[model samples]
Target: MNGTIHNRDKFLNQIASRLNRPRISSKIQKPKWKYQPQHEVYKDATQDELLAVLEEHCKKIHTDIFTTDLQGLPAVVNDVVANCGGGPVVTWKDERFSEWGLDSVMKKEWPSQQIDVFEWDHTLGEENIDKAENANVGITISEITLAESGTVVLFSDKDKGRTVSFLPKASIMLIPKSTLVPRMTQAAVKMREVYQKTGHVASCINFITGPSNSADIELNLVVGVHGPIKATYIVVNDL
Candidate 1:
């Protein structure tokens, strides 16, 4: 049912013929770099130490950060949702919501407060995009947390649409403590491991750091122009 037809092979052949080369790919060998400082920074930091780095970076990025345990996550989520102007909230249909007791909050607490909840249902098609567009807040669980840049990685799939995080005015990302990595270097290695072992990974992986902001106008900083203006990161300590 895909409407766009790709003449990729023909295009590659044209270039290959012009260059007098075979249209064949060879195995790529790892480059020997003179220096790899990427692996050297925060090389021996523990989870707590990494958390400290994440916190420091979060401050600079103008993101609110909090830490809690499994038992306290529900409360934290409630507080954050309310702070961010309790929804019309859109979220991924992730099982972690139920596992982490957030499902109850969405179903019960928010309803009692007259807040609307919209979960991305794959069957609904483009309706999911509309929901995200109308929602005040969007919530998601971070698959990987990077301390170096204070970033949260969201792996997009059918149930986790890109618009869920992109279209909302405010966003909240939940992080399990164990998912924290020292930096993108470690995060990329984990992703490569997934691809090597499974032969595939998520189609779109997003690395979000705080709210969307730009200083393009007269060097004046403005937030929420392209995406959410408010961003929150809640790290579950004992998850």
Candidate 2:
């Protein structure tokens, strides 16, 4: 410990000497100003228009988009799962799924499907990750959906790990209409509000536009190379 401390001090002193200043032990204050851009696009679209834009962009990016009312969400989810070949499914432990009646619906509709819910206790970390990695389908809830980019914002927490979305062969996100925003700026503002209320932010905030794709290898496009090959968004309209 003493040697490590001495080395750290020597490193800091060398930098301080080069700058001709003494070492300081103070935290830098973050900027407080909000810079509003002069021109903002897609800011005044009606709800219907925003949905149309989202659908168009999603299709362009090769993301499968489905719309349903609250009552029909269960059926939509069932269809998505069925289309994925009746998966061994992994899901985040979110209360919203239960509130939306998805938990019961899955039990009834997909009796043979193996469903695993992730738990973040220390002992279960590796086991949970393995389950997610092996699962055919992974389902998650989108905190916010940016219509301008057709992107969904996912905040990773104990319940929702980063692997839940990236590891599976197919990923499904449940997005409520009320959570849709016009642009990335609006999504960031909502994230800030969440931080302010919770006094903390998640470790990972993923903005996913579509399935993982790369066109860099010999200019040949490949999908799902680094992540899920297929992505689906179930937009709940009557949320």
Candidate 3:
């Protein structure tokens, strides 16, 4: 039995015994309700306008934003990696990286000892995670980019682990223009559609607005206490 069900049954049985009645096995049901947005602000903004809004919010949160075409992505990636001083780099095993020839570009620009691509079937389990945790730079693709809040959504899977985004000193996300949405509501609807079609959702869905920060102790602000110290989003126009 599920732990929840077993505990519920045990409690119900104890109550029934005290009351001199039989325990019930019926399940409780709750009414389902549809969620309606109170305000649909910027529902009609153009792509350029949305991008501008996203850039403004990103700046407020101290997230660096870079815009480039598909052909320029490799050069942009190279620059970000170079800024990290050529330490261990971790990336997802996404096909988009290969399609954009990032592998070849990294090989040409950096040595083989500097890059580590995470593969799902690899046997280097704990060792691989350690490398990613110590990496100077981590790169991944964003599933959804909410322009309204300057948030990037990532779904973790076997190939795309959550550590790739959280463990590194600096995190870089390559977001395609098509993945950009006007608001978080639209991003949620899109993810719902994906789950409906696939009959499954990722184990973890992370919504990152900017670099990790906390101001809990004595109202002193600290960045990267739990995640990357720096975060960058590269928006590719010609996805």
Per-residue lDDT of 106-196 in model 1, one digit per residue for the tens? Answer: 9988888889998899999999999999999999889889999999999999999989887999999988889889998999999999899
Mark the regions of model 1 whose C-alpha exceeds 4 Å error after superposition.
1-28
Candidate-wise lDDT, in order: 0.91, 0.82, 0.82
Give the count of colliding residue pairs in each prediction: 0, 0, 0
Which has the greatest TM-score?
1
Task: Give residue 165's lDDT in candidate 2 (0 to 100).
Answer: 90
Least accurate 10 contiguous residues by lDDT in model 3: 113-122
Q: List the residue pairs that clash in candidate 1.
A: none
Task: Give every collision pair in model 2.
Answer: none
- For each candidate in turn, the TM-score is 0.89, 0.82, 0.82
Instruction: Name the TM-score of candidate 3.
Output: 0.82
Q: Residue 226 in candidate 1 has what lDDT?
A: 97
Q: Write the per-residue lDDT of candidate 2 for residues 171-212, one digit (tens) a residue.
A: 999988888888888887888998899988887999998899
Assess the local accuracy of residue 51 in candidate 2 as a C-alpha lDDT between 0 and 100.
85
How should the candidates be ordered by lDDT, best one leading? 1, 2, 3
